[model samples]
Target: MRTARRWRHYLKPLVFALCLAPALWLAAGVRWPAWVDLGANPVEKIQHTLGLWALRLLLATLAITPLRQLTGQVEWLAYRRMLGLFAFFHVAAHLLFYVVVDQQFAWPILLEDVAERPFITVGFAAFLLLLPLAATSTAAAQRRLGRRWLALHRLIYPAALLGCVHFWWQVKADIREPAAYAAVAAILLGWRLYRRRPRPAVTGAAPTPARGSSRD
Candidate 1:
């Protein structure tokens, strides 16, 4: 029973890895007709697909705290780092696909894309914001940076917001999906604010009588 109970701890990561298996296979040159199109590059589709997963994983990682609090499953905290690293993996893959396959090693084109495309700009900003969080994720960095590290990691909120905007801006129509993500992000952020709000102090203690003994 103990082992079975602990098995639940592995369930999320297992499911995530299983979901990503297809992407990994595709990345390894396993082509699928469902993903191929004569008008669109398969590589770009792969990159976009991976990028979407990255964004979802990032959101999931951010949701851990709220979900744990709501559910009272403190064990959930153990999975957050793994989910975050998986998010970074997918994001890195997306960036590499664009740089290597789409742009053909053209720095000029890459720079132009960042300058002209708002979606790209926001996505880039999100990636940049995640860098410090990822960097200080290690125990050594946490020890070295102390409280400053936590303050820097708080940038995840804005980073997530930028990621949502980047996704929403890229869609030309049928924005419901993006809007859903944005709503979720908003709720998560709102939860934090609500949780942090100061409450009125209770005044239950009876006022102490003035110090005047029977000397009266």
Candidate 2:
């Protein structure tokens, strides 16, 4: 445990860099279009990439628990918060890019998209749900919220489901990618439900009366 704890000090930085790399790469593509091609439709490419990473990281965050249980390495939990926050980070960037770049901050059109477009509606809902989770992810917040914290965090399950639906709806066809994500999410969430299922109470049988003893 000591070694794992010590190694985490180094590992966290590496993990953080890995999580940030996609965003950096996207930024570099924008900065050096000559070197890094963002395809013919750069705006769409960037937005999709950011949203993809959000979904990937969200699923990864959910995987940590099953991974820990399967591998018996409790240390896997150390990275959950980081991964979840990065998921929120990417999703927020995804929304910002769509609003600022795609819509040019046109409130009427953006609101219309949210209201009329099913994919956008779910995606926006997912982001709204994630907002509180990210805001309350701090240790201090967890301490302050106590048991309520766990209940609040449960929102991730629905957020993830909505994210998957958003992705599936956004894609014109070829749902294999979103299907895979949904499958993994199902397994992870199903495992959690299985674990939390109420077990039959272990009732002890009443002791037999002493042989030949009085009924008093």
Candidate 3:
């Protein structure tokens, strides 16, 4: 209980650091040919960066419930909004890199690419879905919308599915990493479904006492 009570103070920083660790590592001059452009393929590097961040965010989102349950930390709910926002940030970065750098902001080329690439279409759809959820994550929006806010936010599940599909579809070889993420997502979604199932109710009928009456 004390751990639960004090969780809010530490949760945000811890989650943020965990999420940013990879990006920070890249920023700190870790120049792997896969990540850095020094004779490396820039497009692949950008894809790798964005894809890792997206998967990390998705995993983090799925982890929230399990972590909260284990820690008895209800206040961890406060971190969800920021965590979600960071996920959106990374996904948007992914999209921007593809659009501006890879496609060079050419609508004709982008349309052709999207049409030719089913994975791109799925990823684009997922990103579009995340936009509204991130936009309405504030307290003001929550208060204004009430139950409807929750209903809209439920799209996260499908968005995550679409994201996983996007990743899976895009990979040509060494699909182990994407498969691992998909497995994790399946387990998370399964856990959620299990939690939501209806429980059997106990009947109020009680057993009668023995027929022999001592008082008589």
Candidate 4:
């Protein structure tokens, strides 16, 4: 209906802004360096915030199909692309912040971190997997790749899994947050797999022998 379409149009921008809010908030920290002790370690704070949002948005992107199926509203698909793109943006930001600010683009140090730190390796791998997914997100690539697009997009599961592991492994003390994220990812992926499973074949019970008809 017209109302539904109007709401959808309105929601796109609203959701976009909502998604960007965390990044914008983090950026504001630069203006007020002493705001809540962020000045002391702004890089680490921004890095962690961006990384968390990236995982959250990736999980949001993965929820689309299940949401559509559950609600029977195909319109939800319209937002999935933007949501996924924002996820990639957050992830790219997270990684770039680490490489540029934290590591100062020092290749030797960066390579050492990737090689020696298990959590960093996992996070880097997750970022790498998201790269192709982001690149092929356009209509041109989708059409050109055809079935291959779906197959490539399936990489999201592994990427999300790696992200969860990376978060869990990186935590110095508590892991409840990462565990919660992992649970959410597992549930979402499980739902997707459940939806994809083939249904059992239905069969009649020998046709009931025609209920004692003429062929007695």
Candidate 5:
């Protein structure tokens, strides 16, 4: 277990860097657009990339519990909170980029988009769901909230679902990518439901048939 603990220490930082890599790459592309081709439409590319990473990381965060259960390794949980927070970070960045750059801080236009666009509506709702999860992610908040924390965190299910819908609805065509993400989200959620299903009680081997007293 010394080895396990040591690996945990090293793994967190490595995973943190890996989580940050996409954002860093996007930042570099923004900084040096001439060197890095963000396609003809850099802003759109960056926005899509950020939103994509947000969904990916959110799914990854949800996978932690199932992964731990399947593998029986508690270590997989070590990164769950970090992964969740990064998911929120990317999502928040995605929204901010849209509001600041894409929409130029135009609240009227932003509200119009959210009001008129189904994709934007769902994406904004997903962001709102994630907001509280990110806010109360700390150990202190977890302890203070107790069971309510678990209940509140359950919002992630809908958030992830909404995010997938947002992606699918936004896509003009070629829905393969969004479909893949939706499939993964569905599997993860299905596994959670399967795991949580009530099991049949053993009843101590049927009480040895009670010496054949009227019933088998």
Candidate 6:
């Protein structure tokens, strides 16, 4: 009991700090860009890391549901929002790097990429979907929106599917990593569908109506 109590006390802050760790390390890497050798193509490396971590965190957010189901721990839901927000933060970083470092905010290049590059187009769409979800994750928004919040959040399904497609399309030759991400996404999505599937009705005979009551 004492151990569980202590764990509950520290869990939120620990998870919060861990979520921020990647951003902090990425910032340090930027400061020591030359000192830290990411790869032959540093820009690609940085962008890949940002996008990969964002996708990974997004998967983690989805995994919480299955994890809770298996473990019967409802508290797991508490961290889903944090994971999603961190995913969004990493995605924002990914875009900022592409815009500021790669494209240099060139309007022509940005427009051309979005229009011509399927990967960039779907990635941008995924980010656009995330914008509203991240915006309305607040308790106040939940209260104000009520059931509408859940409907709005369902946008994540398409957003994540697009994110997987974007990653798969961006890969040049080696597709194993992207394939794995896609597989994870498929499993998560399938799990949700499986859980929501309608059950077969009971096979028992219909019950008799009361003498005074007529069936509606």
With a 3 Å backbone cut-off (N, CA, C), the pairs that clash in candidate 3 are: none
What TM-score does prediction 2 earn? 0.90
Q: What lDDT would candidate 3 get against the real structure?
A: 0.75
- Cα lDDT, all candidates: 0.75, 0.88, 0.75, 0.85, 0.88, 0.82
What lDDT is reached at residue 121 by model 1?
91
Model 4 alpha-carbon drift over 4 Å, by segment? 34-39, 203-216
Q: Write the per-residue lDDT of candidate 6 for residues 1-216, one digit (tens) a residue.
A: 345445866897898898888777767777887776665787777888899888998888888777766665556666778888898898889998999999999989999999999999999999999999899978888778877787898788888888999999998999999999999999998988886678777789554222111111
Ranking under TM-score, best-scoring first? Answer: 5, 2, 4, 6, 3, 1
lDDT (tens digit, per residue) of candidate 2 on 41-87: 99999999999999999999999877777766677788999999999
lDDT of 4 at 86: 96
| Residue 177 CA displacement from its true place in model 6, Å | 0.6
CA error at residue 87 for candidate 5, angstroms: 0.1
TM-score for model 6? 0.87
Give candidate 2 misplaced runs (Cα > 4 Å).
201-216
Highest-TM-score candidate = 5
Model 5 CA lDDT for position 26:
86
lDDT of 4 by residue, 93-147 (tens): 9999898888889999899999999999999999999999999988888888877
Better of 3 and 5 by TM-score: 5
Which of the predicted structures, 2 or 3, would earn the higher lDDT when compared with the native?
Answer: 2
- True lDDT of residue 44, candidate 6: 78
Q: List the residue pairs that clash in candidate 1.
A: none
Clashes of 1: 0
Better of 3 and 6 by TM-score: 6
Could you tell me every candidate's TM-score relative to the true structure?
0.81, 0.90, 0.82, 0.89, 0.92, 0.87
Candidate 2: pairs in clash: none
